[model samples]
Target chain A: MVKSIPLTKADVLHLLSEIVDPEIPVVNIQEMGMLRDVLLSGDSCEVLLTPTYNGCPAMGIIEQDILLLLQQHGIPNAKVKLVYAPAWTTDWMSDSTKEKLKHYGIAAPLHSSCVNWLKPDQITVACPNCGSEETLLVSRFGSTACKALYRCNGCKEPFEYFKCH
Target chain B: MTLQEALFNYLLRLGDNALIQGHRLSEWCSKAPVLEEDLALTNMALDQIGAAQAFLKYAGAIENKGRSEDDLAYKRAERQFFNNLMTELPIGDFSFTIAKQLLLSSFEFFLFRGLSQSKDQTIANIAAKTLKEVHYHLAHSRDWCFRLGKGTEVSHEKLQNSVNALWMYTDELFEMGEADEVLMEAGIVFSLKEIKPKWLELVSGILDDANIALPNVDYMQTGSRKGIHTEHLGHLLSEMQFLQRAYPDASW
Candidate 1:
């Protein structure tokens, strides 16, 4: 075999950072914490992505984007695998992503140890539109599986928020 | 049957329902009336397929079968399927499709809600995850049902006809079999009888909001729980299993 330059996991992660989510274009996979793991052997790369939700529609597009990103960088034998174990949660999102989502007019998830829906005081989701702590959930579900419908008391605009599971 | 066997069969029905319905919806990918609706339909179909994969994987594990989700979905024959008859019906017009979705999602909402409270942790976890998706699907279908039922006269008439034709098949969904009995006894699954009243109430509320009346005809019950499907399933399987049958080991 001709001398093949070895690739590193860091290089693969760098490449995946270029793949932005299709629905939410402001943040790339890395920012959203969607890129779970990357392995590299010689010139081949394997990327792992955790879906936002169990049946997220953006998953297919994200996989394709990762493939294209690697292929463009001359990594011909790249493979993308989806791992569902240790399931993804809003808690995995980075601080930058939280800021970006707020700036993009979507409420970022509230961090809470309690998963109980009956305890409203325990879960406090900040409003993204007007930076208000006074927001109410309009519906438990939103237009998509990953989001919940909410309205801000400050801005009075209904917005979608990624629910913290 | 053991609790494991009952759980496997129950998961199989859930997976089969989603897989068959997803396959049916995918047939309309490029043929939808508008681009947005097309994307929406395909997105919904993909969601169902993903849910099927989760359930099928769980079922395989419960059965101690080394089969993958793809093997369970693609390799199974029509007679081996255990989905309710509502899932396998042809997607006629937009109205008919919406009507089917409304009925199916309403049933699924109750099913998942009940499953979430199961004594089995794995089954409850899967149900909790799937309930979120089914909630959105129910809302989407309910919205469309309202629009179709109360919109233009032609739309109303078409939607009414679809509901009337499909209402007869709704009883099959709540029909319990031996597997259900075993699961219920084991607390691995809830009794469908317990879910039926909620399903009826929610479905009726949607119909009432849409200004559509429930058909007075007696409900039809099919033996899909026993692997007997409607005539449409044969044609559907022919198309769905074509590639797998042609080249057994074909992969891209």
Candidate 2:
């Protein structure tokens, strides 16, 4: 007879937090709030994930990362289900992650309730280089789908801001 | 007309548009002008294919024929396809392809926006989901149109010629036949009469911004909605359905 070790949601969440987003290396799955729910039943585990955007290319890579992480911890048969009804927004990001983004030379997203319109009020996006809010959006779309191109007036350097869709 | 039949026809049109345009865009997979553009075009193609799959699957269920999306996409004859003629035209050159994209994406943006408010919940949901990508596609194509139309003299001339060649085909995009009328009456689909003016204004404004002149050609050809397609559609169908025709049950 084979014995299975008991694991709780906390244990699963801890394991999941170690998984980082492939695109933004500094942020982990927990920081991105992509880890919605984790459930365990016997030897199998079920995970609920929300995509950053529809048709996001990073989804496939994120799924693979989840499987590898859980399997490495001796838990096989982990299933990841994508939920699309309650679309993801930057508001779901953790406070610590927001702070870390600023520290890592990237401006964190602003809280905007309006749809289809970029934030009208020029909220300070602390310069990723000089830690100043003097930055301007150069283009709405950037190199990647999740980012927007912005030039920091303080540092006079261009950087990518993870857009708050 | 019955609701089920209307839904069937409506979904079929949506599926055909996506599948045909997806096929055309896929041709630029490795042939885009720049590396970023290559990926962008392929990404848009993948989005269209995904939307086609979703719409076709819903169509099969409404038809109650046990036909899968692939069955509908691959097995249907040219006359059975309900896509606009604009999508079936050949990709002549880089300039021509960009011009076609600029026109088609703008039309789709307006069409899908109205569709997001459709009475049919399934169609509405899919349209809302797909509109975000369509919005980006329009922006990308519009930016390119301006660059190519206002760039070097050669590029400007080539892009202008491409736009003129494609202008006559734009009328076919807003042609509403019996199926369209039935769906429009049921509020399942929006009327093209309402959609046409906005489409024309947006497209014309983009061309004007690029310093490109709109063709004065008033005579237009229209037949794709009623199953009468251009000479180009048959060749496109043959190439698209070749593998499926050769091996009926082939699986990836």
Error of 2 at B228 (Å): 2.9
> What is the C-alpha lDDT profile of model 2 across B1-252, one tens digit per residue?
677887798799899999889888888878977766776677777778877877898899999989999899999999998888888888888889889989998888888889888888778877776776676677777877878888999999999999999998898888777777788888889788898998889889989999899899988977777778888788988998999999997997
Query: Cα deviation of A151 in candidate 2 (Å)?
Result: 7.7
Kindly list the per-residue Cα lDDT of model 2 for residues A50-144, writing each as its tens digit: 76655566888999999998888887778998764354667888788988887776677766454343123344556667776788866545566
Relative to the real complex, the DockQ score for model 2 comes to: 0.20
Interface RMSD of each: 5.2, 3.9
Question: Cα deviation of B224 in candidate 1 (Å)?
Answer: 0.6
Q: Is the docking of candidate 2 incorrect, acceptable, medium or high quality?
A: incorrect
